[model samples]
Target chain A: MSKQHESVNIIEVKDVAFSFGAEKVLHDISFDIHRGDYLGIIGPNGSGKTTLLKIMLGLLRPESGTIKLFGKDLKNFREWSKIGYVPQKATNFDAHFPATVHEVVLMGRYGSRGLLHRITGHDHNLVRKSLEQVGMQEYQHRLIGDLSGGQQQRVFIARALAGQPEVIFLDEPTTGIDEKTQGEFYALLKKLNEDLNLTLVLVSHDIAMVTKEVMHIACIDRTLVCHMSPEEYLKESHSEKIFGHDVKVMTHHRHKK
Target chain B: MNFLSLFQYGFIVRGLEAGMIVAIIAPLIGIFLVLRRYSLIADTLAHVSLAGIAIGLLLGVNPALSALGTTVIASLGMERLRTSKRVYGESALALFLSGSLALAIVLLSLAKGFNTNLFNYLFGSIVTVTSADVRIIAGLGVVVIVLLVAFFKELVYVTFDEDAAKVSGIPTRLINTLLIVFAAVTVSLSIPIVGVLLIAALIVIPVVTALQLRKSFLATIVYAEFFSLFSVIAGIFASFYLNLSTGGTIVLIMLAIFGAVMASRKG
Candidate 1:
């Protein structure tokens, strides 16, 4: 691909407005997600952060807005294989669902493989490679329910990676895991962002962690409050303005290698 | 009588053939239904099929065909109601189950009260199964199997995580509709051997028993298939020589197996 095409915006949201019944949830939300952008969406509770991500993934439609994915209108865009999704691990699925880790990850290939097609050797290879990428290759044969919360999240991430998507959307991916596993998960995401250059959209409640890790922060509270780099967002007064309080922006220090 | 002697009777032979086919396909649909926690759907559709059978008897048509048509349409309506969230899933099922049973009773009374034909359908009588019935069951069973195989992965994915499957472009709505239609077909086809009252047990008990093994999804289906076939075959033979109700016998055998499995697992 040419440099111009590579640098084009992967997602474009314009004039998006949505409501649940009588109450407005999101209003006048407009933003562009460029290639290789690790954008973290953080907001107060019931602020439509997950809803915004769902709208972008076409899970929920904005009442009034236009969404263009890969320059194609959302309604007409059918190439879903180019994008992947890992929903909130703790709440989205049945923990005891009778799927092996290998089977769960293999589902990521189904969109690209199309309907009525058999799983080929290539598909299996991709599943294996995705498992390996998440460091869960040894547990591929284990039932997904047998794994811990952190391990299951990694399997879900591996499932998204199996699609070889240009972008992956994660909704509260580290909600139930321990602090150590959460750090490892963030490291894995950073490695994917920096090494593989994959566009990422993370919906999270941990503002501090997100601000420290993500390249861009989109603070959403009923609307697009600010879309800027973390440093710029922290320097500005936008955090307190959206949060409705004097938010203390703590910068956690890590020992450099 | 020897085991081979049963095949000498044409009705017994036809019953076994149709029963075995239903046994195989029931679990194929049953595994998905059981895992999705929609087991009551099978029973609800079975009741709907009874109303269809009543309509067929009144109109002098093939009861199985009319039953298939009615259940398929009712299943679609049930799906609509459930998806619309206008009615909770269990509530929707309750509405259809009782509504159709009432319809069946009124229609049966209109057709001149309880008769042998209706009784045969209520509790299965394998002796009444004809070559034509076997042919119909075989033909429609193939359709159910083919559709299940074609959409196997999509169905599993949707059953696992519906929202993720939708995001992956799997046409989750269509797949869900297709599954219920398959269930309708399975329920209708099963009536000749398993009866309206007991078809759900055929469709559900084996899957439940298999689930106790805690295997992978595909392996669970395989084990369910084994249990279903075992129950059907043994139930048919036991009913034949012992003068028992085929549907009742089949369900009892299934319950026995389920009891044994649970007991063994505990031990």
Candidate 2:
């Protein structure tokens, strides 16, 4: 809302480092995410990709360095409604969990209204619009657990979208879903980013899929290996250092396309 | 005796009042505990409430109020212990459960012996329900219900997924701790009808039964309340006629309901 915020980067990470006990997961990682950027963070299983995402979301604090959201210190950033996060896809939720898709999506409005405040008509419209965005408006009355994995993931994303955030962080959103469903999910993300002007940061293990979809790519291993346009990343062949040489074989096919 | 005549006794009236309140709140809190996979915390806090009652007996204080105070603190402590890296989750509860029982034993011994009054708490004597006990249960039950209603969305969101709740800036730690506290308060308030030994049943059985039905969350809540209230009221009636233990009878009724529901679902 401020003139200064309009000129500021969506996220700024500087020299951030994190460790788990004796094992150092991230070392001196730095990157800036601008408005309207669809950035994909790709790495191997133990490569600290999720940890880095958690740090950026302020869920886990890095051992060293500073991170800012909306040009304010991550610790001091109070306007959480501006950011939405969809956690890992293996929800482990109860099969009989009593909540409907509509109820789950309405949760996104909670941060704005907070405790004791009722969800207003605007919030309901946002929930409906979010479900519509995910092409899940018809399934609003369905139990979340009753839906297929892909449908459930869409509902989860709709829950995040109902917040009406400027930026959304998704952690391995397509895992466990089938390949064809993954394509549709990516197309949905693309629409959300381009049409809604929503900044998107996604963590995924599928290098070929990520490289083709995201406008920018941040390849992270123990640290950030490269932050560049997808075209440059596909050409430079630096992905091997992050995802290993197998990634070169994967991206090589993409580069020819 | 007819059903109308059962209301003549003041103690039975108080018993119904307290049982009704516990019936609604116990399973209400239990549903969340079950969802969070913290169902065992209810059992552990119930044991801790027994210790509170023992300490209250030794100190000549109101056992229900003392149990209420003690279990609230223990519940907060359990929340901290639940995250202890050194102890496994169930093992942590085991420690509290056994430790609280041990404390109750020591307090019971210190008081010289378990008097008839003290014995009433261990197995529940709704036939001897005091006006003071009813007042406390009513007041505490209302507070717990109010808190649950006010934060229903946040509680459900957190129970469904804690990490997502935290990143959404929902004050997840506070809600998590508050939920445990509510469980503690529910256990303490329930002792008059269910007793410490059977209080966990009051909290868990209704919700487990409701889970059998394919219902929405709000419908599940309403259904659980209905089942719990039926068990409490019917158990009291059965106990009065058969001269059986009130707490044991109530839990037995609920267990029978749970078994029937599970069987019907399987069939």
Candidate 3:
């Protein structure tokens, strides 16, 4: 909201398009993420939300257009440690993976240290601090697989926080958590955004919750239908357009009661 | 027989030395492979190593060296084929495994016949280990262990989540290449001690046993090496007293240990 931070573009996507064989996933999508922006990308299933996030993260190459991260082209961007990512809640991780919470979080430091470098005391302190920030410090010694889904998500968020990244991208983080846990999870994200000044880009299908939490929303269905403030999106009725159906946008206050 | 008497013979000493070295490195390699769900690749590479051994013997070179060379190529091929997105990783392994087995059989037949000495390489003979074999095992063990320690962090990160590792700037492709190459070296080097048919057991069983205990990653690795060393040492003793196949005895010991671990967990 500050005038000085208005011009800072943490992420800029220009006319990006992607397709898997004949099925076009994303087409000519454009968006901008300012510094300290809490961006929520929402869409229906198979609407290319995850694909756009992957393109921005450089996991998937777009068929066309350019992405700039922190004012540097994504291809040339070398400061990856400054950007953190928590994938869709460890669905790919084995439940019996033999790693403790502390060990899992320590992996975040691997990017900064490169190969062959030993983790210093400063790094260990940061890991502890990150766990503390996420209020999971006491469970640091527990096995990652032993934790519940919500706890695992917190540990993952702590893992991302350990790197001290300026921005973080999360993909469907609250997939399996209960409603109470989801509220707690959103509150944690809100705190991270407001207190630490961490820019966030989260992709989710929970339109009502996401619109309430994020300052800006990007509705995508193959291409970006609109990128506007949550209030503006609700007023303009972008949900029906994005979902390709008569969707209702219930305000967050309805859910609070 | 006294333990000291067992060590008096040069062949027994060499066998023990090489077996111990193989025991250490195989589990170290196995833990990563199992964690990454690439355990089948171990069996595939082991089978491929046989073709290398056969080719080496046909050309009057050291079979172990030839096996190493062949496995390196085959392992790299497996990695490439899996990444091509044309086939599933398991399917790729099956293709390579069958291809290598066919090549081994052809090479064996072309080399006049499956002589008893060459047969020893396939089934493993503890009494036939040379000083050269001992040196090679020691050298390879040191290199693998050193490289593993140096890249431990990166490998762990990559193994847990490859996409996250790549986005984190860990050079996942290079790390994956390193893992497969190390796996090749492990399988090839293990051929002299456990033979082609049983090398996968030496690399995989101990890690599987460790995973059942719910230990942390480093603890899992340490326990795997311990179980591996136990199986090799005990199997050597069993082979010495019972006059059984060294590699077969070792694998059986591992299987027995696995059964016991699983049973205990059930209990």
Candidate 4:
């Protein structure tokens, strides 16, 4: 990585916490993600990963602490053109809802265009290019509900890419796809990081594949455990720290694999 | 009567103009209303809006003014009922519908001499409509259509994927409030033609008919607008020939169109 890329922080989350009604989901958490860093967030279920992402994106306000994006306060980042998001597979949307793939991809531009403006020629060009990114070019005019699972996921990624976002946060983008496609999905995300220099935050439970795919890994169980490089994460001591008593079982399982 | 006869005939032209304007926007709003599973809300809110018009009559004001004002309030209440976490939106619609009507009845019976022409607000008197009503409905229709065009993509996005819209930084709450207020304005205009009990048919029938053929959002809006525009005109003329109530005939035609379209889609 370039010295500037390594030094410049893209996301600075400080002492963040959140709760639904009264039940607190996340305790005090703090972390910093550098520009072009592909960071993976891993945790067991109900570990508040999704909530933390929502808080970072300004969809949910933390009970305490602050979030800063690109050196400015998160709330001040009104430029949606800078960020892309792929929510979990379940939220891929109601397939029965009427929209062509091209129209669906065009929605990424809606945030930047606001209410008064219509899609222009430039917007259409970007949509076409984005569809090509995820190999959905031929399905541009097809209804979204007609696509298979992997194709739908690709369509969603293309929709996010249409915004030309500098940073992408995907909440479990590989779910439900077969093992082979899941590997391919990771390769695509990695390509995005290297080609477009996009900063990424991925939340997933699959530790085995994530360490190979991402540059940085964070252990989150309702708090920021630590963030480290893939090499650091592979160390036995770090594995002991992350998995604790389960580390023996994990190592034995890895042996079987 | 000559070519200028309708304009020369005054009330005939006024009623036609008013019916046309209502027919345009009600079904346009109905597209999202049906999509978001809010069809029942529109139907129930029409009844609640009627209750608001009754309260206006009981208070001895121009029923439209008070009706418009109270219906706006009632529309907000409907949105709140839908959003409140403890309340299931469907059941809340039923509760609000019945509750608002009961309140209207209490206020109406308490007022002196309400049982007479007061019922005209329930099952509109289209022939009794005046030129002023025509102007208001037309003006409101223009505003509604303008907003719809300007906010088409945003509105569609919000209706289709509310969580996505919110996460993407769209002002979804404001858009939702605008929809409810739009529905209230639509209901107020429609009551003059179809009455409260049946006005929802004006909104639902055309959109439902259009849904059978439309495979895209853009097409859905076009077909919905066309269906309503022509249906209103046909219903008005049909009533004139049959010597019947304009709103009832319009809705019957709309339902028949829906039934025919459904059968065709099946066949």
Candidate 5:
């Protein structure tokens, strides 16, 4: 949780704006991320954390401004090998999809394999290696739907890792997971950061957990209010500024528990 | 005996061949239909296409061609309805089904001659099918099936999660429209071989049977194909040997297979 890596400038967002019809979601938001930056994006519900991540990944078109990854526009750098995404706890998946964990993970390789290319031995090895990395090698043949929420989250991370992307975007990757699993998940991500130097940008409402996990934090609420280290963002004064007056009562200094 | 002679004489070869191809493709499309929760879309399109064919009779054009055109138009409407956010896909399909059937009834009443041609369209026959029909069925079957296999991964992804598919950079919207288009056209053309009432059975039965035994996506497709082939062949020969209706017999065979699979799965 230290501000260690500072020179890479891997992602650059300039004056980004987004809206659904007439109502705006992100307003003139801007930010920059460098290599090995595990940036945590946090905000209250409906704060456009997911939308901002989607725009960064080129999944959603911004109403204005530009987003660049590794000096190239995001839309232009969609070599699946260069990017990874773990959508917010894939709860929307149909339980009867009939695909095994191995098969689901293999789909991550499809973008890198290009159109009409079959899953090759290299892709299979990478998928297996990703599963092993997530400690899910044992569940490789099991139906994805049969897994627990935490196990399923690991599977999704494995899927993202299978792409071998430099930067991975995880949309609230720890939702509905137990506290023990959440701690292990954070440790796993930290290991990825230290060992492989994988860049991570995650969205979540778990401020305390994210402060313990991510190094840099973008505390968002309909705008790119400020970018700071998690500790600074967690300061008593900053928390009030970010969450407004009502947040003071949330941490009431009640003498009795 | 008279109907048996049609198959025994080989003069009815084209219709029999056409029936064989449609029987296979209907179930292939049906697998995705059921997965996407759009299984009823097929039934609706089949009924709508019937009205289109009836209109064709009133205009003296080929009923098959009109059915294809009208189904395409109806499919476009279904897509628009699905996109409207307020109207669910199932309700849209039902609306089109009811609307088309009513139009067809009125149109059929105005046609010059109705009984035999309409009966053949409704119940299907080996006697009235032409070489052109067989050729169309074969070409469309090959193209649709091949396209499906070629885009197998994308199809599977979309069938399970449309939003995920779109976010992953797959052309989910285009693929969605294309699927309904493919379904509508295939249903329109296939109904001439399988009656509209039983087309749903042909589409649903094979996949249901395959799903009982197969867990993987690819295996399900292959097993569905196998199930379809079995039902069609058994239905054809049974209908030929016993002098029964080909369309009805084929659907009954599929339904029997479905029932057996359900019973086995339950037990």
Candidate 6:
């Protein structure tokens, strides 16, 4: 890929509006996700943060406007393998689901491998590499339900990584984990972004943590209230405007330059 | 008669062939259905198959073929209603289950009365199974197995997480439809040996028994296959000598295994 292509906007959302029955959730939402961008979307509960992410992921369609993925319209885009998704933890999965960690991660290759194609040794290697990246390679043969919440989260990330996606969309990835695990999770995301040059789009409600971890903050409350660098986001009054209160911006020691 | 001597009877051989085939394919579809909490769909389809059998007997057609046709169409309708959210899953199943049973009763009455052939269908008579039934069961069993194998990973992926599978471009809608269709076929093929009323038990009990072991998905399916085969084969032999209802004996054996598994797990 050329440098110009590397810097191009990979996702373009314009004038998107959505409603659930009679209740309008999002309107006039527009944003651009550039290559290698680490963007965090934060909003109040039921503020359509996850809904917007779902729309972008093609799990749901926008009522109006358009979404362009990889410079192609979302409807016409067929390259789903280029995108990975980690849904909200603990909500969408059965705890007793009988799948080994290795098997779960191998599913990431299913889309690219297509139907009737056998799983190759290369797919196993990629699954292993993905698990190693998340530091869960040793637990590959264990059932997914047998792992802790933090470990399960890591496995899910590994499953996403196995797809070798350029961009990953995470919906509240750290909702139920402990604070320490949440910190480590954010660090992993940062490493993937900085080391692998993977674009990250995270939907979260932890304003402070998201603001500290993400390069760009998109504050949403039924609309795109603000999308700017975190430095500018903190300096501006967008938090108060969206949250209906003053959000005290905490200063954390920057461990990484 | 000795076990070897039982094979001397052509009907016995045919019944075992058909029963064993149904045993193999039942759990293959059963595991997915059980895991999805869609076990009742099998029962619903079986009930729907009863109405189809009545229609076939009245119209002078192959009841198995007609039942397959009805159940397949009904399965598609059930899938649509479940996905459309217009009807709750259980309620939709109830509607079809009761409505089809009522239709079967009316049709049977119109046909003058339930004959010995229909009685065998209602409760299963392995002794009455013919060579034609064996061929049909074997042929449809291969189809169910092939479809399950070809989409094994995709079905597992969908069963594990439907939303994630859809987002990953797995064509989950098509997969879901294929599963229900497979269920329809399994239920219809099972009716010859397992009977209409007890077919769901044959499809479900083995899978439920295997779940008690808490094995991996593939291992669970293997265990369910073992349980199903054991029940079908053992029940056939015992029913042959004891003059018991074949379907009832098979289900009772499965329940006994389930009970033992539960007891062992508790111990």
Best of the candidates, TM-score: 3
Best by DockQ: 3
Residues A50-74 of candidate 6 have per-residue lDDT tens digits of: 9999999999999999999999999
For each of the candidates, give the backbone clash count. 0, 1, 0, 0, 0, 0
Compute the DockQ of candidate 1: 0.68
Regions of candidate 4 where Cα sits further than 4 Å from its true position:
A1-6, A234-257, B1-12, B80-88, B91-95, B112-119
Q: Which regions of candidate 3 fall more than 4 Å away from where they truly are? A: A1-7, A246-257
TM-score of chain B of each: 0.98, 0.97, 0.97, 0.92, 0.92, 0.98
- The window of 10 residues in a row where model 6 chain B has the poorest summed lDDT is B1-10
DockQ, in order, for the candidates?
0.68, 0.60, 0.76, 0.43, 0.38, 0.67
lDDT of 4 at B93: 82
Q: Write the per-residue lDDT of candidate 3 for residues B102-207, one digit (tens) a residue.
A: 9989988999758887778887888878899899889988999899888889999999988778878899998999999999999988887778889989999999
Candidate 1: tens digits of C-alpha lDDT, residues B1-267 = 787887899998999999999999999999899889999999999999999999998898889899999999999999999999987889999999999999999998998848899989998889888888899999999989998999998998999888888888899989999999999999999999989999999999999999888788888889999999999999999999999999999999999999999999998
Can you write out model 5's per-residue Cα lDDT over B1-267, one digit (the tens) per residue? 565565566635776687778877877788898888787888898888889888778888877778889988889888988888668766777789899888888888888546887777777666666776677778877888888777767777678655555546677777888888889878877876676666777787788788776477777778888889888877777777788887898888887888888888788
TM-score of each: 0.95, 0.95, 0.96, 0.89, 0.88, 0.95
Task: State each model's C-alpha RMSD to the native.
Answer: 3.6, 3.5, 2.7, 3.8, 4.1, 3.6
lDDT of 2 by residue, B41-114 (tens): 88899899989988898899998989999999988887787766677889889999999999998999898757
Q: Model 4, residue B200: displacement in angstroms?
A: 2.6
Among these predicted structures, which one has the highest lDDT? 1
What are the chain A TM-scores of the candidates, in order? 0.92, 0.91, 0.93, 0.91, 0.91, 0.92
Pairs in steric clash, model 2: A98-B217
Kindly report which residue stretches of model 6 are placed more than 4 angstroms away from their true locations once superposed.
A1-6, A237-239, A245-257
Question: Candidate 5 on A211-237: residue-level lDDT in tens?
Answer: 788889897788987688976777744
Clash list (residue pairs), candidate 6: none
Model 2 chain A scores worst on lDDT over the 10 consecutive residues at A248-257
